[model samples]
Target: MEDKKRVGIWIRVSTDMQVKDDSPEHHERRARYYVESRDWQVEEVYRLEAVSGKTVMNHPEAQRMLQDLRSGRITGLVFSKLARLARSTKELLEFAEIFRREGADLVSLAEQIDTSTPAGRLFFTIVAAMAEWEREEISSRVAASVPIRAKMGKPLGGQASFGYKWHDKNIVIDEKEAPVRKLMYEIFLDCQRKKTTAERLNDLGHRTRNGSRFSDTTVDRLLRDTTAKGQRLANHTKSVGEGKQWITKPQQEWVIVPCAAIISVELWEKCNAILEEQLSKRARKGRISEYLLAGYVKCTCGTSMYVFSTAKKFTCKNCKNNVKVADMDEIYQQVLKGYLNDIEPKMYVEELEKAIAEKEYLLTTSTKKRAQLRKKMDDLVPLRVSGDLDKEHFAAIYQPIVAQVHQLDKSIPELQAQIDFERIQLNSTDHVLKEAKGLYESWTKMLFPEKRAIIETITEYITVGQDTIDVGILHLSPSSKLTSQHQFMGSWKLPT
Candidate 1:
C-alpha cells in the first residue's frame, strides 16, 4: 500500500460578493474533493480572506504554506485557480520555481494544472506566458495613450501642482494658494534663502494644502517648478522598478501645457537664477537623509513641527510641544503596521475592474454597430450609383447610417481612453499592494530613501497633540472620499 500524497489548500477571494457567492469554504470543499480523487491527504488550509492576488508571496498565509511545502509537511498545494494563487505572472513563476525546488506539486483545479506531471508543467508555463503577454499589452496601450492625453492638455492622473487646481479638465490658479505661491518667489528674491522664506511664510500663518508648515525643501521645490511660470509640464517623469522610484523623463518627451502664470516670467527667472548661483557657490556634500516625517508632522495648535539642528526632538515653534525623535519613530512604525494590515485591496480593485469591464463591453458593441452602419452606407452608395434607389431615398437611408457611424467613431475612442485610464489605475493599485506586502516585517531593513518614499506615498499628514497622535492616511483609490485617521494615546511623557 503506497502512502497518500499530502497537500495544502490555498484560498483567496478578494471581495465580499466573492466571499458570499464563491465562499472560501466552497473552494476548500472542492479542493478536498479533487484531493480525494487523487488519494492526496489534506494537511493544512491557508486562507487569505479578502486579500488581493497582485502579489501573494509576501503575504502571511502564503509564507506559511510555502514553509509547509519546504519542510515536507505538505508535498503539494491545491488552489481553485491560478489567479487565486496570484495574478502577477512574476509571482506565479516564483511560486512554480519554489515548488520545483522543494520537490512539491502545484494543482490549480480551474486550469487543470497539476505540476506533478510533465504535461501539467508545460501547460502552466504556457498560461503564465500568456498572462505576461496580456499584462504587457494593457501596459503598452496605457503608455501610448499618455502622450496623446498630455498633448491634448487632459488632466493625466495626479493632483495639479500646489498653486493650481484642475477644474473641468482645465488647470486654473488656486485663489487662496496663488498669492502664497507668488509670495514665495518674492520672498526668495528678497532674502535669497529658502529657509528664511519658509520661516517668513510660517510666521505669516501660510500653511501647505495639508495644513502643514512649509520647509526649505518645500520652498525650493515650489520655486523650481515651471508650473508657476505658466508652462505645466506633463508626462515628464516615470516610476521605475519595484520601489516605484520616480525619475525624470527626457525633455523631448515632455508635454508642456500652458496655464495661467502665478508670477511674472522675469521674476521666476530671477528667483531661480539666485538659487542656481547659491547652489554653485555651496560645497557639494553627500545627500543627507531627511527626518522620516519632515513636512508631515503637525501640532494640535495647527502648526507644523520641525526638528532643529540642535534638538533631538520634533518641536512645534508655536506651542513649544515636543516629542523625542526615537519615541515618535517607534510610534510611527506601530501605526504603519496597523495601517497596512487594515488595507482592503478588494474594494478598490473591484471598482476598477467593474469600470474597465463596462467600458470594454461598450467599446466592443459600439465597434460592431459602427461596422454594420458603415456596411449599410456602403451598400446604399452602390444602389444610388446604379439608379436602383432614388436620390431622396438614398439620402434618407444613407445619411442616417453615416451619422450613426460617425457617432460611434467619436465614442469608441473615448471608451478606449476611459478603459485605458482604469487599466492604469489597476496597475497602480497592484504596485501599491506589492509594495505593501511584508512592508511591516521588512521596514527596519529598508534604507532611509525607501522608507521616505513609502511615507510620502501613503501618508497625508501626522498630527502630534498633547495627549494623542493622529495620522491621516492617503486614499488607496483616487475616487475614495473616505479619510482614514488612526489615533493613538500619547501616554509617553515628553522629556523635562
Candidate 2:
C-alpha cells in the first residue's frame, strides 16, 4: 500500500473567553475529521492558546510546526481555516512558499483549499489575492472614516483618556478623574517644570489612564496633547504602503473637532509655553533630574511608584500610598536592622561569601603569574650553580624578575586583605549593626545618587499601604523574614 500522507493540525484562539466556548473544540474536531477522511496520518497537533492571530511571529507553536514540516517530520499541514493559520497576507505568502519548497500540501478545510492539485492551487491563489485586497480596503475605509468622526467631535474609538471616559461612544467628563487632571495642570503651571509637575501629580496619587507612574516625558506629552483640551485631531497620517508605513501629514491637513475641554485654553497655552521653555533649557544643558526609586518601587495597585518632591515623598501613581522621605528613612532603617540582627545572620554571611568569591576570582590570574615568575627565578638559580651563566648575566635576568615578584607581593597582600575583611565581617554582628547605624545617621548627608544606589542595592521594592510599609530585601528571595512585601511599619496618618 502507498504510504499515508503525514499532516499536522494548527489551531489558535485569541482569548481565554474563546477557550470556554465550544467553537474551538468544534473547529478541532472538524479539522481532525477532514484529515482522517483523506486517509492522512496525524503527525502532531499545534495549538496556540490565548494568542491573537494579528501578529504571525507571536505564535510559538505555529513556528515549531513550520520547523517540523521543513525537517520532513510532516508532509502536509491542515487547519480548519486559513485565518487560523495566519491573518496577514505576508504571512500567508510566506507559509505558501515554505510548503512549496518542502514539497508539502496545505489543506484549509473551511476555505476548501487543497494545494496538492492544479485546480486547488488556482482557487487558493485567487482567494489569497482577495484576502490581501480586503485587508487593504478595510484599512483605507478606517482611515477615511477618521475625519468624519473627528468632525463630529467624538473619540475616534479607543480607551478613554484621563479626565474623561467613554459614554455611549462619546467622550464625557469623568468627575472623579477631572479634579486630578485640573490638579496636574495647576501644578505644572505653578512649577513651570514637567518633572516637578509629574512629582506633584504622583504625590497626589494621580496616574495616567494606563495606571503607570508618571515621568517627565509622559507629563510633557499630556500637557501638549490637544485631546485633553477637548479638541479632536484626526487624519494625522494616511496609509502609505498598504498598512505598513504611515507618513504624518502637514499641520494644515489636520482635522480639529471641538469637544468638552478638560482645562481652559488659556491654562493649556500657559503650561505648554513653560514646557517649551523647559525643553529648550534641557536641550542646552542636556540633562534632567533622576528619581531614586523610579522602577524598584511598585504600588499596591500593581503599578510603579513615581517620586514626587512637593511634600518630599515617593508616591504610588495608582493608589493613595504617599509617604514622606523622613518616614521612609525611619522604615528603611528598621528593615536594615532586622536583617543585620537575625539569629544566624545568614543574610550578612551570604553577602560576605559573595564578596570573598569575587575577590578570589580576581586574584586567580595575578596569583598564577606570580607563581610562574617565582619558578623562573628558581630555575635561574640552578642555571647559575651549573656555571651555564656568568654572575653578571644571572643578575641581569634575576633583578627584573625579583622586581616583578615584589610588585606581585604587594598586590597579593591587598587581595588577601579584602578576603580577610569580608571573612571577619561574617563572624561579627557588631560590624553589620555598626555599619547600618552609620548609614542611617549619615543618610541625610549623602549625595542623591549615592543614597539612591545604596537604597536600591539593599531593597528589591518598597511597597506602601494604608497602615504599613513593606520593604523587600535583595539577597534573600521575597520569602525571607526581613524581605516581606507586606510587613507592617507602625501606622501614621499620612499628610494629605
Best by TM-score: 1
For model 1, what is the alpha-carbon lDDT of residue 295? 82
Clashing pairs in 2: none
Candidate 1 per-residue lDDT, tens place, 1-496, comes to 9988989988887874263225576567667766765667999999887787788889888899888887899999988778888888778877876776576888876665676644455655665566557667877889999999999999989888898998999999899899999999999999999999999999999999999999999999999999999989999998753235699999999999898999999999999999899889896889675688888888889898888756678999887888777777887888788777877777767877888798788888887887777777777888999999999988888887778866765556545445544554465565566557678999999999888988887787788887677777766554553344545545567433
Whole-model lDDT for model 1 versus the true structure?
Answer: 0.79
Candidate 1 accuracy as TM-score = 0.42
Which regions of candidate 1 deviate over 4 angstroms? 1-290, 309-311, 481-484, 494-496
Off by over 4 Å in 2: 1-136, 237-247, 280-496
User: How many clashes show up in model 2?
Assistant: 0
Report the Cα lDDT for residue 336, model 2: 68
lDDT of 1 at 4: 89
Angstrom error at residue 183, model 1: 48
Q: Give the candidate number with the greatest lDDT.
A: 1
Could you give candidate 2's per-residue lDDT for residues 1-496 as a string of tens digits? 9988889887777654353222465556656666665567989988888777777654678789888987989988877677888888677776776676577888776565666543356545665566567667887777777777777766775566677777887778899888887788898888778888888888878787779878988877678877678885676655553234667788876887667888888898888888777667768554554655556666567776666667677787666577766667666766665564553445656776787788888778887898899889989999999999999999999999999987876666456444533443343333434455456557678898987777766677777776667788764321243565435445557545
